[model samples]
Structures are given as structure tokens and as C-alpha cells.
Target: MATDPIHQFQISRIVPIEVGSLDVSFTNSSLFMVATVAAVTLFLVLATRGRGLVPTRLQSMAEISYEFVANMLRDAAGTEGMRFFPLVFSLFMFVLFANLFGMFPYFFTVMSHLIVTFALAMLVIGTVVIYGFMRHGLKFLGLFVPHGVPGYLIPLVTVIEIISFLSRPISLSIRLFANMLAGHITLKVFAGFVVSLSALGAVGIGGAILPLAMTIALTALEFLVAFLQAYVFAVLTCMYLNDAIHPGH
Candidate 1:
């Protein structure tokens, strides 16, 4: 074995099934996505099914999640944004679970891939643009043309603002993909050290202990990153939605 931990990024076909025009091959990446979605749905559905007032731990978690997102939207986008809470809550939970699920042994990290993250960013940015236009029509264009700037400098400022707005998807996707990919790769690298060194003999086995300890520490940090990344994604999304709602503000 070469012992290069980064080599695990390969996306393998679990089943090379082909359907005439569709060619619906199952892949490791797709498997993780399905698992993440299933995990999120099962947790939420099962957690809230009882609707208990005394509340078990699962129910408490579910209630906390609801209040967190609901309050976030209310605070950021005001009462009008409450209508979109279901979509936003689901989005946050899905991403949170997806990132958290990937931290396990032998699990495929879907969020580590740019295609997955980019697709998510596109959906968010697309909704912002579409809703902005629907709500404001041509007036939505005014979002890029900020107020308080002199008419003489408006063209220059408008171009800069437009460029920045266009960059949103790029930033959002790259931040998530890079963080997930880096965290997993780091853990893998440390683990490879533990395996390779322990195989060498007594002295090497002593060195292996340190790598094992490091792996545990890194694993815990990776879990924190999973939650942080999800929170960042949800908060940024709310902020962007806020702009669409209050264009000039």
C-alpha cells in the first residue's frame, strides 16, 4: 500500500447499472447524499412524532432546532420571511447532517465535492434572484445600484456591486467544499501514520501511539467543523435573503 491518505477521494461506482438513455449508475457520492437525506428525514420525523410536552432528548433536540432556525429567520428577515421557514429549516438540517455523516469511518463525504456544494449554492442564489425579481420586478435591479452614491459615480459603483453579487455562489461553494475536503484529508493522513508506523515493529509502534492520539483530537475538531459549516451556510443564506427582502437597507 502506498499509504497516501489523500488517494481516498476517488469516486467509485457501486453498481455499474446502465438504463438506455439514463445511465443511472450508483456512485459512492450519491450513496452519501441518499444516506444524509435519509438520516435528516428520519431524525426529524421520528423526533417530533410523539409531540410530548415533557420531552425526551430527541424531542428536545427537534424543538431546539425549530426554535433556532425560526428565531434566526424572524430576526434577520422579519415576519414576512416566516413563510419560507420550512424550506430554510430543511436546507439547514440536510446540510448539517450531510457534513456530520461524512465524519464516520468508511463514509463518503458528499459535501467534499464541488459539484454537490456548487449545486447547493446555485439553488440558494437562484432563489434569491428569482424571488427578488418576482417581488420587485425591474426594481430588483435597483439592488445593485445602491442609494446615497452620486449619479456621476453610480455606473462605476453599479458595476462593482454586480461583480460582487455574481461572486456569491463561487464563495459559498468553495468555502464549504474546501473545508470538508481539507478536514477529511487531514484525518486520513494522521490515520495512515498510525497504521504505517505500527506495522513496522516495536519502536515504530511507540510512535504510532502519538498518531492515534492526534487522530482522536482531529476527529473531534472535524465534528465541530461540520456544525460550524452548516451554521455558516444557513446564516449566510438568511443574510442574502434579507437583502432580497430589503433591497435598499
Candidate 2:
């Protein structure tokens, strides 16, 4: 069969298992997800293992990663937001590593999957909602009602705000999932073109040059997109969490 670019996204069972009606089989996706977690855990642990007055390169990297997310949360939600540092940092690292790991050949990109991304998005918004209510009581509903609006406009504006708030999870998830999916698919298609063109003859060899160049260029761009998407996901989560912190705004 001709290689299908979309086939790269397929989930295959690695170890079949069943518990009653549930097919809780281990899959390629599951394996990569576990690997991603293990990789991140090891990176941070090893990088920071030797905390020193004069930092080693790995320690510097670990510190840089910590400060990056810490500053992001601080800027978005202020000092109080630091309380959620563990949550935000974990999300950022997981997504960032998953993205980078996916760029490797034959590795599954968990974030590219809608279910995975949507679940993550839901967790973010769910945390916001739960904490908002817990911290602010009924006042948390103020998030859907802006301050200083004319009485007549308040109803309309509040409805709009509620819709926007509700749409966060969907938009957040789709943004990450779609970006990763489209970027990878484009890379694969261009790569396949290079192979297909090179197979033809002398003319084919000449034709392959364009795709070969495009593929190389896109490889660099894809790496950027991978990091950028992860950053976007983390920043947006901070912003959303900020709303929960200060719903009056």
C-alpha cells in the first residue's frame, strides 16, 4: 500500500487487554504518553539534581524552564497565581516535551489528538471554575458579568461573556490539536513528495529538488511551531486562571 500521510496519526494497540466490556489495551499513543511523562520527570530531576552556587549547564536549563513558567504565571495572574505554579508548570512541561518528542520519527504526538488536547483544556477550565467558586463563592459568577455596564446592556453583555467563557475549552483544545495535526500532516506530505519524485527517472530527480528544499525548510518551521504551540497553550491557561482569580475584571 502507498504510504498514507494520515496514517501517522493512527492509534494501534500494542498490548491487547480487556476488562469486561472495556478494552483497556495499551496503545502506541499510551506508550508515547508514558514516555513523555518519564522523559520530563527525568529531565527536571537530573537537571536539578546538583543544585549548586555556580550552576551547571543542566541546572541552568532546569532553572530557566522554572523561571519561564513562573514569570508567565506571575505576569498573567500576579503573585497569587504562584499558588498554582505546580499545576501550570506541569501542564507547560508536559505539553512542551510532548510536542518536541513528537517531532521525532515514529513517535506519536499526544497533544495532536483531539481527545488528549480536549481533556487537557477541560482540566484547565475545570480548575478555574472549581477554584473560582471555592474562592469567591457566588461572586465567581461575576466572571460572566462585567463591571460598570449600563443596566440595559448588562444582560446582553453578560450573556456574551458567558458564551465566551464557555467556549474557552473548545477553542483552547482545537487550537493546539489542529496546529500540531496540520503541521505534521504538511511535513509528511512534503516528505512523501520528495520520495515519490525521486523515484521517477532523470526528470523526476530534477523535479524532486523543489520538494526536497521545501521539506528541509518546513522541518525548521515545524520545530518552531511545536514550541510556539506549547507556549501558547500554557499562556492561555494562565490567562484563564487569572479570570478565576479576579473575576471582576
Candidate 3:
């Protein structure tokens, strides 16, 4: 009976303030984005405010997070990328918070949408291009050439490399979007089954209990998925950065 996609992902005009032509409507999705950012900001700010010698729970969380991104950069991109740790860490935290916040019963899943994921992917690809060109000047285009390939195979390998490089955004965005969409839709379908069966008599209602339990279990599983998807996005982005930094391999 709930048409609102489990009655959770509702789109609404929150502020009701409209510009002359801009029509800047504040949506539920926008509100959830703000909440996610605010929550993350508070968490990091409070967690590391004093930098205690004896780590508190919040401080430990902050330290763990810092080490995660720092080690990721160190392992994947080496010392040169240490300078870029802030960028990478911010990206990971933002995406992670966005995905985790969406797992709440009524919160909006920002990364579930293709446009949001695509925009983030575009940012990653754009950064790679900019950094590559900045580091290598005009020679950055040499990235498309295969290093060990013979002279005759250079053309074919270059074409494949070009396709692979160009498809980075496509690959990155699709992974997040498809996973989120599928998880949410599958949950919704199970929820519908629970509701429909529970509406009938005692036997039918008892039958619905199985799906109800499954839905609850799946909801918990989805929480894990939300975090994993965000981490996957960040790790893949870092891997792409590695390619840009040391190309032709």
C-alpha cells in the first residue's frame, strides 16, 4: 500500500521559497545531505578537539579514520601522494557518511542516484586529468602508450588504453549506483510482500512473518552494503590516482 518506496524516500519541498526564475526548492534529499555533512563534521570536530594523550572513544574513532586514509595513500600511491591525503580522506569520509546516513529509515540515499554518483566520478576523473597534465605537461598524453608492447602493437594497445581511461567514470559511477538501487528496490519488494500477506487472515499473516523477518535481516545487511559501497568507491578512486601518477604500465 505504500507507494513512497517503503515510505522512506519521500521527495518534498521543505522551504517553499522560490527565486524569480531559479526555483531553488529545498528538497528532502538536500536536507539529508546537509545532515550527513553536519553529522560528519561534528563527529570529526568533537572527536579530535583536544587531541588527548589518552585516546577517548571519539578520539580513537578519529585516529582510526585518519590512519585508514593515510595508510591507503601510503600503500597505493607512495610518498608523493602523502601530500594529497587530505583530498583523498575528505572524499572517503564524505562518501562514507553519505551512504551510511542513507541507511536510516527515512533518510535520503544521495549516492544511490546516478547523477550524484556520476558527479563524484567525474570529479575523480577530472582530478586525474588535471594532475596528470600538471605533473607531466604535454607529455601526459604519453600515458596511453603501452610500455612493453612492440612498435606494431602500439596502435592497438593505445586504443585499448584510451578506452579504458575514458571509461573510468562510467565504471566508478555504475558500481555505486547499481548496488544502491538494487539493494533498495529489493528491500522495497520484500516489504511489499510483508504488508500484502499480513493483511490477510491468521494463516496468511503467519506466512508474512517470514518475509517480515527477512526484511529486517536484509535491512541490517543493507547497512553493511552502504558502508562497503562507499569504501569500494574510495579505494577504486585511489587506484585510478595511482594509474595517473605512474602511467604506461
TM-scores, all candidates, are 0.93, 0.97, 0.91
Candidate 1 colliding pairs, count: 0
lDDT of 2: 0.92
**What is the alpha-carbon RMSD of candidate 3 to the true structure?**
2.1
Over 1-249, each residue of candidate 2 has an lDDT whose tens digit, in order, gives 245888889999999999999999999989999999999999999988898989999999999999999999999999999999999999999999999999998888888899999999999999999999999999999888877889999999989988999999999999999999999889889889888988999899899999889989988998998889889999999999998998884
- Give the TM-score comparing model 2 with the true structure, all chains together: 0.97
Runs off by more than 4 Å, candidate 1? 17-23
Which parts of model 3 have CA positions greater than 4 angstroms off?
1-11, 16-24
Give model 3's clash tally: 0
Model 3 lDDT-worst window of ten: 1-10
Better of 1 and 2 by lDDT: 2
Top candidate when judged by TM-score against the true structure:
2
Best-to-worst ranking by TM-score: 2, 1, 3
Question: Which pairs, if any, clash in model 2?
Answer: none
**Predicted candidate 1 versus true structure: per-residue lDDT over 1-249, tens digit per residue:** 447776667888998888888877899888888888898889988999999989899999999999999998888889988877887887889889988888878777889989888998888889888988899888889889988999999999999999999999899999999999999989998898998999999999999999999999999999999999988888888878887777773
Per-residue lDDT for 1-249 in model 3, tens only?
A: 473464564468898777887867888878877888898899999999989999999999999999988888878887777767777887888888988887776678887778888988999899889998888776778888867789999999989989999998999999998888788878888888888898898988999999889899989988888878877887887887876687653
RMSD of 1: 1.8
**lDDT accuracy of residue 28 in candidate 1:** 87
Per-residue lDDT value at 101 in model 3: 80
Per-model C-alpha lDDT, please? 0.88, 0.92, 0.83
